[model samples]
Target: MTMNALTASAAALFFNHDGEVLIVNPTYKDHWNLPGGAVDIEQGENPYDAAVREVREELGITPPIGRLLVHAWLTVPGRGAQVLYVFDGGVLDHDTQAAITLQASELSEYRFCPPHGMEDGLIPPHLAGVWQQALIAHAEDRITYVPVRL
Candidate 1:
């Protein structure tokens, strides 16, 4: 890939039955984002495997993977350009589970919250308004299953 070509990455938006958003507070950054990470090209890794692995690693819950919701260009300051691939995650038996806690080294917290609870004031400045937009896109039926790029 060219230097300017943003590396592709995958993320899981693990939504509860009530539609609550699962946000991960990461150890690497002050801002919380969905569970996901870079695609390990060295292992010949693809985006779907990376997404599932990230969710399992961060939350310790591995639900049946679901559809694609949104795809966009996400750039973390100083982390370089990244093409973000977000998928809709499905869960079962919500009440039986304990809240997923952040892994100490890479995560600080994880929680299910009202979609509106994610806002400018509380959200990381870089990702401030994204959750709302994602919800809006979902409500408007703009979010749909996207085939992973080959």
Candidate 2:
């Protein structure tokens, strides 16, 4: 049996003191996304490193990434088979939130969105589901492995 090769991506979940999650509006994509990008394995960058790098590149912040939150295996249409690593960005204080500066070429704007209405606010149905699972895992203080059809 031939096994399909899998690509990897990493994202970080940042929640404000009010519990609103941070989402970014990228200039290249119509939908909003979590702060992250694909792992730069070619440059010897691991998933965790990718997460940290993406945050700094996209948001211009160097907040410490917390524990691993979720591991999602998805067969994203067009993107193909992949594994996604989500890390906890922890709660962002007012001072940290004030420090964010968006990369104009990549991102347009960012917002702290209340968790309750994420499905209506976030783009791509799969992300909403994954975010929901991630939220639960964060609250439970455990890592969740998600295998879902997207």
The TM-score values for the models, in the order shown, are 0.75, 0.91
**After superposition, candidate 2 runs with Cα above 4 Å error:** 1-5, 77-79
**Tens digit per residue, CA lDDT, model 2, 1-150:** 125667889999999999999999888886888999899878999999999999999889999999899999887555568889999999999998999999999998999888866789566677778888889999999999998676
lDDT of each: 0.67, 0.88
Best candidate according to TM-score:
2
Clashes of each: 1, 0
Give the alpha carbon lDDT tens digit for every residue of 1-150 in model 1.
Answer: 544556877887666778777787778776778788888877988888889888778777777777666766655454456666677675435552474645677888777777777773545654544455556656665663332222
**Regions of model 1 farther than 4 Å from truth:** 1-5, 75-80, 99-101, 128-130, 140-150
